[model samples]
Target: MALTTLFPPESTATPFATFATETAATPFATFALSSTEAAATPSSTIAPYATALNGVNQPMNILFRNAIWWGLGVLAMLILIIRLMQRAIAHSRHTAAMGLSGEAQAYWSKNRYSTWWKFKRHMLYAPLGKKRHNREIRLSSAGNIGTIPSRFHAILLTIFFLSNLAFLAFLDYSRSDRYSVLADLRGRSGVLAIINMIALIIFAGRNNPLIPLLQISFDTYNLMHRWVGRVVVLEVVLHTMAWAIVKHAATGWSGIWHMVGTNPFISWGTVGTVALVLILILSLSPIRHAFYETFLAVHIILAFIAILGTWIHCEVAKLPQLAIIKAVFILWLLERVARMARLGYLNYSLKGKAWTSATVTAMPGGASRVTLHLPRHVNVKPGSHAYIRFAGIKYWESHPFSIAWVEHKPIHEETLPRQEKETPVEKQLREPETTTDISFVIHAQTGMTKTLYEKATQCQPRQLTLNAAFEGPYGGHHSLDSYGHVVLFAGSSGITHQIPFVQHLIQGYNDGTVATRRITLIWIIRESEHLEWVREWMDLVLKMPKRREILQVKLYVTRPKNPRDIISPSSTVQMSAGRPKIGYILREEVKAQMGAMCVTVCGPGGLADNVREVVREVQDVSVVDFIEESFTW
Candidate 1:
């Protein structure tokens, strides 16, 4: 019997049986049905079969979604528990060491409990390769291709990728018609794609609530965003291909093309798929790094188009996946709104003071020191950065710059002029005059930075002041106050990030509020002239009372003009002609370790990797923690 003869187009009695018979003739033809034909076809017979299919699919979708949420919750819970346990341990050790002499303190440091220390050392903190965690794999001096993921990150990404694959291939085909099975596969892929979009949007946001709750860095979230975006693109491509295959098999190439041209559902879906493919293409590491601003602008535009197309496609198709799309859209909207609010609040002055202004001063080695004079006080801390926009230069562009220094100057009534002090209104207002000066030392690497440097150099005294606006004081809340020993490593311009930590920790030590007993700052620069970048700040830190007792500064001139120029200023402030041996320094620090040690690095990829490796190697011998500050997006 002819397969089509057994199940005529007019039949409506048994939809599954009919579909089975028709599909049996040419299983590929199942997807070729035109929209008109599909609409004209009887639906009553297929309703029961679809309900049966849903019995399997609905639960699977629910399970997968719940699994993602539960996974995040569990991870967050584990981090919280670990933090509490560490605090408890620190308190216990502090109490025990309070009465101990130097020898007893040393003994206690060596004998402290460390059940999870080994696991963290070998698995959590360990790099994919030995000692290369934050270092980028550069294609050349001008281009950094990427960096290796930590072992812990690698494991999580693997599980996430595999889970997505499992969900994509989970459709059952037992006793089901080929047409029905193919349709089920298409639906599953589409549903999964929509679901993954939630994660894609969440991780892309700067104000992602999960960051603080889970203690994950923005760099890690950026990594997750890229991977999740790739997965979403893959699922979208699969979903589109499945539909195309079925359509082409059912009718012909012409019929499928005709449907796409005439059918809103097919046309909108095709548009979204095309946009997503373009996003994947333009987001390659090389292309993204080469034309970051252009890439970012286009990426945002294309992403919006893709989302709008998908929303419309779902609406016209009446797919249940619209709920997921709605959720993703809401998240994207919320992030944008929050970002705008932050910018407005941070930049606008309401107290009749002038708007923020930035003074750009050219420095040696193509770098600029930008000082932002703010109208109000800002809570400045170590490790903080801000996104700054220059209204007179490039109003549309905002770049992240680390806060290198923050100064607060108080206004005294006695310092006011005699005429102003005589005013009755001025006399009634006795509040202290306070202003904040936030500064960033930015290296001229590309676009806006290069322009800023050029403009600064053109001015007399190589400095220019311009109107500007800035958002944040973001990041920098990572605490090093609990550790007794702290080691900071900075390379070239990366000193901007580490300087604040040095200042904050030293102040804490002076106030007797922190557990820190020792601090070592290692700064590596290309030329000896680069030392002038933080000269004033370093002088202030050096002059602090009791600084010599607790602080040690090491300067490494990697490419000095004259090797003899690299001279040690003092015993505590040492200078070297080449890179310091990171491993050797770490080992020595570990030998004389205090209660606990914290190793931090914000430098070139090579330095970060070296520091990471050294920390991992000595983790088992001491209670050590590593924190790396990087902007990898």
Candidate 2:
């Protein structure tokens, strides 16, 4: 009789007892359900030869797991070292470049040979093929299969995958009984799956320590997260298959079904495996992109069930991998708790419990501007972003938005408590009080954004205030202060990211603090009305000290009401009716390029990709560094 035939399907018999009996009846079953002697062993059954192989395999699993960490640590350190060296090499040049005349600027812009530039050209900056990486590969208009990873990222992933294959293949295959071999295979894959689960959790965290540690962008970490998750799923499938093959060899398909239904451990494992398969299917780019909100909710629920099932599976069997499962559970729990605590402190005031507030105003284009009033001061950096959670609309959802404007409103002494009588002059000499206002320009596209726009338009004056809380000032790890020449490319709402940098650099240029000598902003939009979106802020920027001497603005209107509507505001700020030639602009800029030019793009994938391609091509001709701002979920 098969194991399930021993009792009714609802039998309450202990797993230790049922498993012990199954091992006794079928010798081949020893590969899945351990010998009665091995109730103490974790996920694998122990055959005669397994007794010898188990000792060697368990230690190797730990070694291989540590090896993964060691490799990552080395890679992180290498990147850190490269950044430090670049800073040191540019330090003196930065000071010299800022003071140079126009003729001297041309001399400093000449290409200097560096062997490392090839690696940057081909691997670091290169796309998977000719030129299609950041831009999504679409089947039709709305179908998205997702963008490809960079060549360097692809290489690292391939090496990692091959290493996993090699680790699984590292076993000695001289055993006479093939069951022992399968048993060993089952043990190794199980360990790999559990260890990789921990990596998956780490990569997926919004506060991933690796991002700051390696100076890598969150987008790159997210890319690694998807691949690591796929690896975990693959190892899980292999582990399940090995168990089923051995179980069937012992008592046929009926035995496989019986064992799965009869034992608690087996049942939980089967549930977990099935959940993982479903997750893999739904997480495909088409489904995930099309129905993102539903996908997110279902994805989390299934992942929780999967983790819970496997945790109990290992616990009941007293499996060695149980410790790894516990680690995974604890890691996930800690991140969630940390996020909750941060939100509490950041959102609500401790004294009055007054939360942060938001004012949403419908802008000229299909966009809404959210202005947050905070109770205290926050020093926002250029190139930084925050996660905004708006109440009464997607209350549980927090989306990352670039901080476009930050203003601190100081409380005058006239409004403050008069502890002691002070003259107006003395009061003005005191330090300024610090209440803050931060604003984000959000383009209405889907789900939460679309609803926000609709709601704001319903109210009079096309504006409404709502309860809101924000979570961060994450990112901003990059700085362009050391570059003598800088070019910023923005499309539509992307001007939000570039504005803060523009203001900071201009203020710095007047102060003679930063090395920046020249700055150019290229903004591309569909309609001229979009200019109304940032007109107020751009007006203030235009009037900055020495702005006319150092900054130039180029506005590209892809489609406009009339050609005259695209007229230049001033000599410093010019306008065009059609698209700007990406290659031609870069070539002209390079001719007069100052020492160490840097090109930055924050826009749609197509715009960013085009800018990236031009930057890569001009690298050999001139030293142009490229940085793209991307926040892919």
Candidate 3:
């Protein structure tokens, strides 16, 4: 009945085929048991190996399989649901704030198809679609929240990272002369260490959630991460030590390395051990990592080398399984390279000028602005940012800068490369532009901005060449739609991100698309030197007839000796004191603006953190209503 039968089924075969010929009767027709089998019968002989399972092994295989299933199935599903709910909450808050009633928002949310629409928008970055398809989707859902990475990623990585912990713990237990530690335990520990090491590398190479968290705060997680690393290093040490001790008790240290190096199972592991030790040394101070930038570069290069060594150590057998493990790293590397390529192309080719040039102009306080001129049309929204690199002076590394605004700019046309199936006319429109221009406001610090500030003050606005790369229009302040008044608080260089937002809000009011809420800008600078950068923009905005109806600007300089020294608009809400804490404002000023008021703050980390804490303490509102960008690394 089957299309092809390569072999006969066991159920249909004769019973004699199940037994070995040697174990059967000598004569095929005779029924007689062999002497060896008769002696080994349960009533005749006792068994020894049958006790090993209950004696030592704990049925780990069955337990581990069950754990894995529960983790991958039930846990993963819950995480997926959590991600969906978070996004739904954010969307509902946004829509409801636009004057929609709770029932109406609920009705919109009830549509199950909208979840699929959201999923499509989030996953547009996946390479399943053609170039034209991607372009169309990018246009349609321009401001959708990108993707929230799957939480199962964190769960799986935690399992692997913890597995390494278990192996290390076992190794330590065996080494401590504890009753639980024995020869068999040592052997099991070594095997588990090897298995966990291989698994850690595999999980790590797949862009695990832990990687991004590490990049952001190495210190917070470094203790646990380092403990695991030390364990792996120690396992290699103990594995070698255990074998060497046995051999040395018989032959001494003369043949230790030779015996260890000759073993195919551990030869590559020996090399990997040396590499890990070297890495541990370099990771410490006096060698490097004291400097942040240099530390990051060296750390990345050494980490890759360490991972390579680990892979080589595991692949001694040259098995297909090991080859597949190595291939995962190769694929991950390729994906990262692809991401870099896409980012580079987007940055280098903006409109047609090849690069944007800027000149640093001093502001009233310690702040400075670098004005940029574009060769052609380029469009970026208020919250959008571009990575900018200036000519000469450490321009090799580009840093992110929020787009202030373009005085005159055109609507950008979305361009797509012509497909093989497209008509020729469509191809003409898709031809790439040669260049474009953009500007960035640099908040002077110790490194790149320090150099820029010196150049700006010492010389003319030099004809600088810079490479511009764009990343996102990711976040915006709470819109003015629901709020009766919008209050924006920015400190020093923080205004670069906030100023454009205010402009966008004012325009929203002017267009009458949303409520004409009052707009208040509070800017705090340590000194008068930084105010020069915004002097022109503040003048222009104040002069506008449309802005006159709603906008108010307040500037506070902490070092002001007299009231006249402050460079702020007329009728400013000037305060004289030490730095103003958000908590103070919440207790004193927020009561009057409590209802239908949305507060947005973007500043240095300390101020931003304070604002968030204050808001949480004072208001019982959803997280969607209060937005803060600290720009903390």
Candidate 4:
């Protein structure tokens, strides 16, 4: 009675004796405990009946026992049938191979071996390459396609599931006499459960260090970061549920309350649970997440709370490891914050002190270009970008621009006189070791570029006091090493980024530093005039030997001028009338030139999406050969 109340109460309890004795109501009851005992009692009438074999109970028991035998019998038959089918298929293949010519047979055998090696090689190398290709393998820690950071984590999860099953089996075997099943949670394996929980946390916390590596793209990276937090939340919920079930069966509902209050681990668990629930509610499709600015703020707060809870949950003893994790995330956060602060300060200080003049020239088809004048000896790099602040805009955050030109220091010939007293300022005026004219193509997009175009065309000889704070040279666009071919995919306005990359490729090829066999440039855009913005790039690609010898150019125009336009040269200079399909572009157009070929793509949303699609499709492509760069943050 006490045991009954501890579980669910005596009223709900089903007695085995009661079940066995009610034989008139149910036939199964005759074999139940009470009925069988009564039949076995040594009364004259029952003793004779017990010895007799002709009875309904005998038939019923036999039928019940034979049901298990029938099930196992069917399973064996099914397995035998599958084996025969596989053998038959193998026989057909052998029969066909017997008729092949000697040379053909040898070639097929060699090809088969080569195929096996290729498949095996990819499996071995996939993880090493996954580090470089960061985005593809990033999955939610809860249960997304099983990201394996440590081989140990994967093995642990498998062991956890199996061990729990075994424990459940043990519980069932122990209770076979009573026909009672032990609950899943009561049978949970402690070590395996702990291992699974730890692995889940490790995978969730893996991103604490990756922020800095993805610098200047906070908006993009934050999306993934926030979602990872979401996954962490889900994992914690499951962890809590597992504990809930275990506590309930062992000591009833009161035990749930007792376990929750007494456990130190539960304190952290509660914090994590609350934060996750709040975040999930706020992030619902109908709520504040719909507003980008508000969502960003709330997301950051929730992230902090969740991480704080995680830190406590892992226990204060692991602070050193936790600090290392936190350090990586904090360092990157500090860097972005510091840079933004520096830019803001410069914009204010340099506003009146620098009375600089600038020019804005209108290009064909509604695009305009602007150049800012600084005190002349300002250092800049060809590929480096800066945050630009123009006059008359307060609270308009600085926009990113590539350096177009910088003053070059003069070098003296042997015949010329050498000057003394080269002051620190004079030395500072000297050109950078690797210097080139700074340039960037401005696309008329909806944001800052559109504002720039409107203001520049309207103003006359504008006395613009521009303050620029540089943020990069973050990406290594031209760092081509150990590659035989260079392929660049640039969408409309993405040419600014790709042109410098291609130019570097051509220079490297001519200098013999690069052994690139081919340099193919594919540009996707809407207007032909947009090509004029990067005509210098087009001309260079056309003239370069590496480009001409191995380089091929394909231009795709989604919106063409005439109805007769085709993608090939014979028609309107456009490769295709519709948007370029990534699958088609890579397989039919790019794959022949794919081996040891590096693919770099940059552009708008559509272009980035297309490039991502291609990259995903070619999951088997060598990681060294694929590079994706997005110019916009």
Candidate 5:
């Protein structure tokens, strides 16, 4: 019996199987073929069973691949469903509490709906460990590695990773010959790699549609993107290795090199694989943080190379994975286009007017207050951030800054003629045009911020106006309007995030548009001079109608030069020396909790973590919700 007669090739298209079958007629094939046939199949009846098993193997491989894809879809849909349910419940509760007050409101605010809230606190909202979410775990003062994922993120990621591993490892290779098994495994890994690339692209995108639909933050999606990218890289390497091992075993290293050199398909595939490996190396936390701007530039360039390589590889190989590659490209292109469109819409002046202007004012505490006079009015929400670009400083660099204040001011002022004989028609026709002013307090750290501060300080008045552009008003859509009791915690320049929230809630309370009746703003600063950063804005907020009734301002100067320097100007706004006891304040607030308490922190990692710990401790005792506004990336 011949080798081809007993162990028939699974497919002529399979490289390994084809190579083996083409050489079966050689003299060495007969001895091994006869021994295998004698031992495995003594009877002719076994031939039908062997053929049947081979047929089942292909379908099983297909089923496994389908199952993995379906599993990912199911998991995403489940998460979406849960988020929708939570939103629906919150909306219903908000509607019910609309007109209720006093005891009735307190009755509604009680933890009667404890089951879902408890589940959220423990699972969906809980940190991996005690209140460490959003706080970057640094190896040293200089290196910021990034934060650990929350418990929910960790569980989902683990499940996804394990699913890929199980699919790769548990394939039925029992009845098939070694070459057939290798070919199937290679194909399986390659298919999964392409599929995973879809997720990698989708999650990494800033314009990911799932973000708004599922109510997941960009940070969470970013975390998913990183992990999914790792999975793709792993699969790519595995796919390449499987083919290389089989090719080397059959035709030696010389043949493998020859094929790589000669075959466009193999060459392009190798290019993509190598690019992915390089990406993995460059994306290490320390390297990524240390040289972020450089890393970002190289990362974008390498990503394009990898995508182009993969696309050409699939095209040359005539593989069906081209569909997924196309999807990835389309997603990336859409995100880029969307970002550009947003930038143009936000920063571009109408009717060929001058570009949007930014006034950079150097503050006392090594900070620059950037006030952008936009071309038109835009509704600014609390906690929103924008990526600002200073063309004069560095054209390519854009930094994310929390929007501290947004105001609409008349662009063109109407002046009455000095003569008393001004016509009524002229007076009636002259109306001032209004434009938006968006401001951000940028603390002088390294890179662009430091340069900005230095440039602003160089001016005689410590302020300079220059043409600037900005994209978005991203994030900050998180609402505190639904809660009756809201506590805002800010540390140093983190106060930028809280100021808008305070203003919004106070305004909402005045207008009777929000449920919030009690608002607490706690700011922790190193020096009292730092208070000048938002002095004008704070004065405006303080003087708003009925402000003193609902708002309480607590200023804690951590390193006050003198104890006497900490002076309370009013009973409502009190200044104290030293750091705040986070637990004590939280406990005191919860004791007089009004309704659905929201504790939000935007500050240093340690302060945020401290707030989180205290919030978690008192969650069971009151209707408390934790919202941490930190930009980990």
Candidate 6:
């Protein structure tokens, strides 16, 4: 009896599957057919997976793919468990610290060393290399290409990357062109590339539900998106190269071009790969940073084009992986729709109120202070940020800003008239109100920020008002209230992120709601003139109930014009001229050794790395948790 391939011998739409022989001992024998066998099958088939070699008779690629996903899911569960445990430990520590007698504070200062604590500090939160994790590796004084990942992030990425490499070789090498292994590799890579696209889109969006669910920051999601995208691109390249190599062996270059010119599957697949290649090239650190707005616009457009081409390529051949691509498309569309809906709801009040209005004031330095009045009440957490869209200036673009301050004002049920005639006792029966007022201090560097500053400077009183849109309150997942001692380091405009935390902890201290006993703010700015940036808020914080008892501010003006300008404001707030000794401050703080210290820094890459270096070095002396904040593309 003549043996026939399960798929038509001439079927070009075999989803990269190619076989010259139909034998019972082959890897794809499970789908084998004989000349006298059964019935007609579908014209287009997608057999993209690896099977056992030598004597295997069944296709096991599907099980392998499913296993990959299951493995990832299990890993996520493990991470989730670890995170929850950390939070629980933190809560218990906070509770104990708060309940401690004056003597207990000193007694708990000497923490019991454990292998677990060392691992958490040295490995889990450690930088990828010697000390340059968060600091952007700069090409010049103007810009930087990128920063490296932390140790934990690097390890996870490495493992996943290596696994993909391993999967590409899970086929028989004993077989020749008669049963091409190249075709199998092509199919495998294609499947993996398409499968990973799901995660690529999921992590790329700003409104990813996983952020809050996993208690991970957008910074991490953004990192994951970049790495996943790179992997997808590499797989796609390999898939294309494998196909080209196999076809080249069968037919010459002219024949290859002929098929690409006529076959929609081949043509569209090429288009998708080309578009992705362009995206990868232009997305490099230097190119992206130099032309951020252009890069972003082109990036979005190219991404859509690639997805469209890929979908058509798969659909034309009726591959099962089309479903995966469809899910990716749907997810992308849903995220965009959700973002639009959120923007409309937040910026436009349904009760027929005005759109969100923004007041922009040009500060003494090359900075602008943006005060946004949301149409409705907003709950702005400490260390949270927002993406702002200025209606008049590049309204299509949005920039993320750390919310410097937030206030709440009650829209009382009863309003007193200018000439109130009501009894005083009657006015006391009003409802409780929520907090209001949101503000951001933005330093002008380039692009939108520079334009905003120039526009504000042109206006009367060096301030301008316009309509705007707000999207966020994201990235406040880390809480400092759990620690007895807290050290906040800010470089330049990085102060915006720390101000809200200062206010929250001070207020929490007053209300007996937090365990924080000592709060130190170390702000490093270039010039003394920058002090005007947070003068008003600093005044308010300084006046908080029992502020001096727990709060201290240290200002280091790196470029003070005169010696006298660097004077102390009060006993708690001091000013020094020159860059701070990051290691010195961290060591002194650790030596004082309050119960469970938490050191967080939001600053220039150099400052963050410096702080991280010291934090890592002194972890053995104290149970210190180091947190770094730096957002990258």
* lDDT of each candidate versus the true structure: 0.75, 0.77, 0.46, 0.44, 0.77, 0.77
TM-score per candidate, chains pooled: 0.86, 0.87, 0.60, 0.48, 0.87, 0.88
List residue ranges in candidate 6 displaced over 4 A: 1-60, 101-103, 106-110, 411-435
Clashing pairs in 4: 403-438, 404-438, 404-439, 567-574, 567-575, 567-576
Index of the highest-TM-score prediction: 6
lDDT of 5 at 238: 86
The reply for model 3, stretches above 4 Å from the true place, is 1-83, 99-290, 318-328, 347-368, 371-386, 406-437, 461-487, 511-520, 536-552, 561-563, 572-578, 587-600, 621-626
- Candidate 6 per-residue C-alpha lDDT over 206-278 given as tens digits, one digit per residue, 9 for 90 to 100: 8888777677888888888889899999999988887776566545587568667887878888889998999
lDDT of 5: 0.77
User: Comparing candidate 2 with candidate 3, which one achieves the higher lDDT?
Assistant: 2
Give the alpha carbon lDDT tens digit for every residue of 1-633 in model 1: 653453343223433222222113332343344221243233312222221122124434555666777876787688788776766776776556544432345653452556577777778877876667667777997786778888888888998899888877766555234544455566667777888898899999889987766667778888989988999899899878766665666566885688679878778888999999999999988888888888888998888888988998877645557777988888998998999988776666677346888999999998999999877667777898888989767678888988999876444445555566543332344333555789999899879899999999999999999988878887765777767788999988889998888888778777676677788999999999998788888898898878887899999998899998978999999999988999999899888887678899987777777888888788668777888888666
Regions more than 4 Å wrong, model 5: 1-65, 414-433
lDDT of 4 at 210: 30
Tens-digit lDDT string for candidate 5 (320-352) = 567779888888888889999988887776743
Candidate 1 vs candidate 4: the TM-score winner is 1
Clashing pairs in 6: 135-605, 407-436, 408-435, 408-436
Model 2 poorest ten-residue lDDT run: 46-55
Per-residue lDDT value at 288 in model 6: 85
Candidate 4 residues lying further than 4 Å off, grouped into runs, are: 1-224, 235-438, 442-449, 461-465, 536-552, 562-595, 604-624, 630-633
Clashes (backbone N, CA, C under 3 Å), per candidate, total 10, 1, 23, 6, 0, 4
lDDT of 2 by residue, 1-633 (tens): 554343223233343343332113344344333332233243333222222123234445556767777877787788889877776666766676656643465645656666656677887888888787788878988887788888889998998799888877765466445665665677677778888888788877778777776668888877887888788888889878777776677557896788789778778988988888888889888888888778878887888888898898888776667878998888888877888887887677655446889999998888999999876656788888998888899887778899999876554536544664442232333333545689999999778999999999999999999999988778887777767789999988999999999998888787776778789999999999999888889999998879998899999999998888878878989999999999999888887787678899998888888888888887788778888896455
Better of 3 and 4 by TM-score: 3
**Of models 3 and 6, which has the larger TM-score?**
6
Deviation from native of the Cα of residue 631 in model 3, angstroms: 3.7
